[model samples]
Target: LPQTIVDTVVTTWRLEIRFLWIGSQCIIQDDNHDKVIEISCMPQIYGNACLTILASRSSSVTEGFLHERVISNDILCAKLAVKVFDQTAKIAHLIPQRKNVELEPLYRRAWALQERLLSSRKLSFGSLQTRWFCREMDDNTSLKDDSRDGWTFRERKGWEELERFELLGHWIKIDSQTADELSTQWYFLIDTYTSCEMTFEGDRLPAISAIAQRLAPRLGDYHAGLWGRNLLSQLMWTRVNKSKLAKDATPSWTWATAVGHCRYTDNDLTIPAATMLAMLAMTAATAFPTKISGAASAVTLGMSVTATAQAMETVTPCFILATLRCWFTLLKY
Candidate 1:
C-alpha cells in the first residue's frame, strides 16, 4: 500500500515487460555464497532499466514462478526473472500521490517526497503552499482566467511550459552526458565483470557498470563527465563485494584506482583527459593486484581498447572545438 512499493513495482514491471518483450533469459547464480542474479540474452541487457524491477521483486517476494521451462538454462533464467519481476511489480503499484500539482517547486517537492518516504513525517500544509508559489508571488495569484488580460495569461502559460521544458531538458542533458562519458567504462566493466582487480578497499563493480550505463544516456554532457568518474571511483573503494574480488581478482575498482592515479586534470597536462583515462583503464587490467591479464586476448580485446583510446584521442580536439562553438551559440542566445 505504500508509495515506495507502488513506485518500485511500476519501475520493475516496465523492465519486466521489456525483458519479456525481448525474450531475455535471466540467470541467477550463487557467487561468494550470495545469490547473484544475472539477466541476459544472446546480446545481454545493459543499464539500470532492469534493476528497480529485479531489486524490488527480490526484496518483496516469497514465491517466485512465472513461465515454466523444461530446459536447464532457460529454466534457471526464467525462474530468476519471474521471481524478481513479480515481487518488484507488486511493490511499485501502491505508491500514493497528491491531488494538486505544484508549479516551479521541483526540488522542494522532491525533498518533501524523500522525507515522507524515508521518514514517516508528512509535510506541513502551510509549508507546502508557501513553497508551491515563488516567494515574490502570492498564494492567491489565481491561475484562473478572470484575473489577467488574455495576452498576460498566454504569456504566463508560455513561461510555465518553457520552465517545464527546461527542467526536463536539463535532466535529459545531464543523464545522457553521464552515459556517454561512462560508456567505455561500462563496456570495460561488462567485459571484466567477473574480475577481482580493484583500487579502493570496498567497491561494487557490478552495480557500477550496471547503473552507470543506464544513467549515462540521460545526463547532461558536463555533469555526466563529472559523475561518471565519481561513480567509477565509488565502485573502486567498495568493501562489501570484497570476497567476490578476492575470488575473481579482476575487480572493477582496479580501473577506478588506475584512472584516479593517472588522472588528466586541468592542473596536470602529461596526458589529455581522454587519452589518460583510456590508458589508465587498459593498464589497470594488467597491473592490479589481481593481474587479470585482459591483454591475453590482444587480437580481440587489447586491440579494441587500443583502437578506442586512439580514436578518442584523435577525435577529442575536434570535439572540443565543436563544443566551444556550441557554448558561444548558447551564450549569444
Candidate 2:
C-alpha cells in the first residue's frame, strides 16, 4: 500500500519536473521511481549519495512535504560543502597542496554553483516561504496582507505579531526587481500540487566526448569514458558557474564544434588516426626548445608545470590513439 502511494506521487513529480525543464540538457538520477515525500533520506557522510527526491520515499508523505523547506535548505548546504572539498582537492593536484591559506574564490564559486542547482529559477525561497510559512511557522504572507510591500529577511519591530496570522498565498511579481524578487519566485507550500519549472542550459558535448574517447580503451568501458567525461564536465561547470542561468548564459563552446561541424566527422573522437597523429607530431616537434630565457629555480618550477600541461595538451591525441589501439587489441580474439 505504501509503495503504491509512493509510486503515484513519484510519477507525478517526474512529470512536473519534465514540464519545467523543457529544452535544456540536464542529467537527472534515473532511479527512484517512487514519489513518496520524505525528509533527509540521503546519507551525508557518504558525500555522493545526495538523492534529489521527486516527492518523498517516506510512509507519510505529508510529513515529508511539511519538512521539505528546512530540509531543502540543509541539502543545498551539504551539496555546496561537498563541492568546496572536491574542487580544493583537485586544485591541489595542479599546484602543491599547501595549508594556512583558504580558497575564498573557490568556495564562493562553489556556493554559486550550488545556488544554480538548488535555486536555478530564482524561486526556491518563495516556494518554501509561501508553502510552509503559514502552516509550519503560522506566518501568512498573502496578496491581501499589508506586508505585500516586500519580503524582507531583516528583523523589524512588530514582525512577531504578524506571525499569529495565517498566511494564505504569496503575491505574484511578474517581473523581478530587488524588492519584488521574492514575490516572483514560486514558493511550494503545503499545497502538494505546487511545483516549479527549471531550465538546463549549458553546452558541454565536446568535452564529454573527448574524455569518453580517451578513457574508453584503457578502462575497457566505452560507457565509463562517456560517464567520466560527462561527470568531469558537470563538475567543472558547477565549479566555475554558480547558477544554471549563469552556466547557460556562458558562451563556452567546445573544441569539437569549433574544429568542424559535421554530425560524425568533425567529432575529435571520430577523426582519422593518421591525421590526428600528424597534428600531435607537429605540436611535440618543439617540446624543450621553448625554455624561458632567464628564470630562477622557483620561476622555472612554475613554468615547468605550465609547460608540462601544454605538452600534455599537444600529446593528448597520442593518448587517444593509444586508448583506441588498446581497445581494438582487446576486441581481437
- The TM-score values for the models, in the order shown, are 0.24, 0.17
lDDT of each: 0.27, 0.22
TM-score of predicted model 1? 0.24
Name the weakest run of 10 consecutive residues (lDDT summed) in model 2.
186-195
Best by TM-score: 1
Q: State the lDDT of candidate 2 residue by residue for 1-333, as single tens digits.
A: 344334444544764644222111122333222111111111121112222222222223233332343323222222232366457322111111111011212111211222222211221122123211222232333334433323333221134333211122122111222312221111111011011111221222221222222223332222211122222221111111222222322222222112121111111243223222211111232322221111112222221111112222322332222112211111111
Write down the lDDT that model 1 would get. 0.27
TM-score of 2: 0.17
Error of 1 at 113 (Å): 19
Model 2 lDDT, residue 4, Cα: 31
